[model samples]
Target: MAAILAAGAGLHPARNAAAAPMPRVAAAGWAGAQTLLALGVVPLALPEIARYRALVAEPPLPESVQELGLRSEPNLELLTALAPHLIVADAGSVTSPLARIAPVATFAPLRPGRRPAEAAREATLALAARLGRDAEAQSLIAAHEARLAGAAERLSGDRGGPLCLVSDAFGNRALVFGGNSLYQDVLDRVGLRNAFTGATSAWGHATVGLDQLAALDPTTRLVLLTSRVPDARTFLALRPLWRTLPFLREERVTVLADILFYGGLPSADRFARLLAERLAPGNAARG
Candidate 1:
């Protein structure tokens, strides 16, 4: 609990006109796959199914969905065989050949200046329209908005300090989420502030050395994204300046599970809920 109560807590149910045949969709990356599921449409195929499971683990891809090899270079022959009605991909995620196989629609989950969650909402509606799942999309969107709002209210007590969302990137350096990242947006929605304010890449993070981490306010809390680094705690301990981080010494560090940091509504919803659920008063909690 972020407090004395449980934090507030998906896809599908609303449907398109019964006369229309359900579209057979193939999604290229995690974001498109998530949107399809949320809109009550299952992808016929997606690349990197295993990696998507290991990295994003949510909104669950159905067992019927075929795996299409690497996301960067999906097996074109197999995709052609699937013969999906439509292929949804991240903009510029794959090469031109993907378009040659089937009609391709590109989605950008993260956009400059706009909140990812908001962007996700618009994308969901748009995708729903394309998939003839408009009714389901409205239901999903309404539910998502409510869940996030409830999570925000649950953490109104200010149980802990502002958080530094980060993951290890070898040596003493870290890949930090701050400034305009999707994590930053979720943190804001959940009533938490991001520790780093400097500008970051369009994807919303920067790789900085231990010197930058050392410069954070002493009271800033640390929330390590550990799904990518199961031994993150141990690895951090090995850093020369690890013991010097004030939050670590004070036990104000927390660990969070996997999140598609650059993903869309599904990831935004996951982050908001997980943060409120995992972050409670005191220290060293794991979400």
Candidate 2:
């Protein structure tokens, strides 16, 4: 069903309202927005949608979407003005106020130990049922699986050495996803093994000092860094000491797309495809 942009042009209604109830959706976070979009539902308004402008560069968003934010808080007045039937939000901080605005449905990040793809698949299916588009949800999952399979075939036998996924910076301090993270899920699908295979927490964000990283196995093949900070070159330049690390010495550092790494969703597929292009056989070897 085509989305209906309200007369104000800010609120987009679902054209399939008769077949599926046209509920106005408010996405509190980018991941939620992505999940909803993948389900063929466009939110009426989103507060943090603008935060993801850079993300669309590699994956691109549909032109029919619009965003509405009333500052840090979703404008309850604006939400009421749009007269939405449902609101989808993250289970984190913004839930209370968002629920006050309307009947809000909350979703959490994929927990540790759970398969990332399975969690994402289940969430998409549940969301589709909520939107009355179960068939569309199944189709999306199939397409995602097909894309992943194609990527896997293309990168077969080109698996790089064990890699570490890090976020944040300075080398003095960093956050790494050990074994149980959505990032790990992507790594697993792409046939890459994580270097730090210790016990991971339920949600999996382990902050450690650079000294710990320096002590890691010298054979570590590559490091994938994800951060909110822009100017990856500048970030790397600031960490001159990091160059002394074995991985860096071997010229095995790759800065990943922040959105695909941090944001929830199988959007990691985009990053996986990019990795395949860079690491596949016949590609230039690291310095």
Candidate 3:
């Protein structure tokens, strides 16, 4: 809760103003790394940089950036060795230990009660300010808005525009994203509607059985943010209800590669591009 409060005020103040330009920087959270990258600031270290490279192929981090292990539990020894002037972490992450090593600034894409999408934008701007890259940040934000608007224009003629559902599945459970999720904001930006009307947790997801898919509108389109292992199709095949779902039987399901669901503006931009490219409402409905 205190972390969320800290995030609401934009980035928490960096302790050492004398360390302007932050000669060496490191990010303890994936979202923070993405924000720094978007601002054209190459952090000296990032959590799971290798895995991040594989997951989000675009906008690669430099080879020099050291891997700081898991985002949740960063390698303190390796991180301290870097001797970074600043370290960025998520508002929800535990960063007390990092403060002892360097100045810590927190960013939160999902600030409590605030829309995740809006919070992401604010975080991006704040991050840019930290690095004295406000101009670059504004340009990036403008480009992002243009992309969203362009996607909406292209999908304007979509017949079932607002009846789309986005989710990720694992084993027998489905993590349906809607309501306060950042995806919902993207959907609205692109003139598409989220079909899930169920209650969501503060982070904006509801875990439900596959049978819940049957409860959605018959015309609803399902776009899956798929993972590599335990393919959704493999597990869904075991459930009779999965087969009975209209979207599945009619071949109206679109599977997209997993992107950072809780990342900053760069991720939002990636999501918009992926959704616009894969989502063809008229084409799917006709098929």
TM-score of 1: 0.88
Q: Candidate 1: minimum summed lDDT over ten consecutive residues — where?
A: 1-10
**Model 1 spans with C-alpha error above 4 angstroms:** 1-18, 229-232, 238-240, 281-287
Query: Which pairs clash in model 3?
Result: 162-193
Tell me, by TM-score, which candidate is best.
1
Worst 10-residue lDDT window for candidate 3 reads 1-10
lDDT of 3 at 9: 26
Give me the candidate number with maximum lDDT. Answer: 1
**Global Cα RMSD, each model:** 7.7, 5.8, 4.0
Off by over 4 Å in 2: 1-18, 55-59, 62-66, 70-72, 227-234, 260-264, 284-287
Q: For candidate 2, lDDT tens digit of each residue in 8-121? A: 233223245346545566666666677777777777666645566665333345655556563257667777777666676654546566565666555444644566666666
Instruction: Give me the overall lDDT of model 3.
Output: 0.73
| lDDT sort, best first | 1, 3, 2
How well does each candidate superpose onto the true structure, as a TM-score? 0.88, 0.82, 0.86
Select the stronger candidate by lDDT from 1 and 3: 1
lDDT of each: 0.74, 0.62, 0.73
Clash pairs detected, candidate 1: none
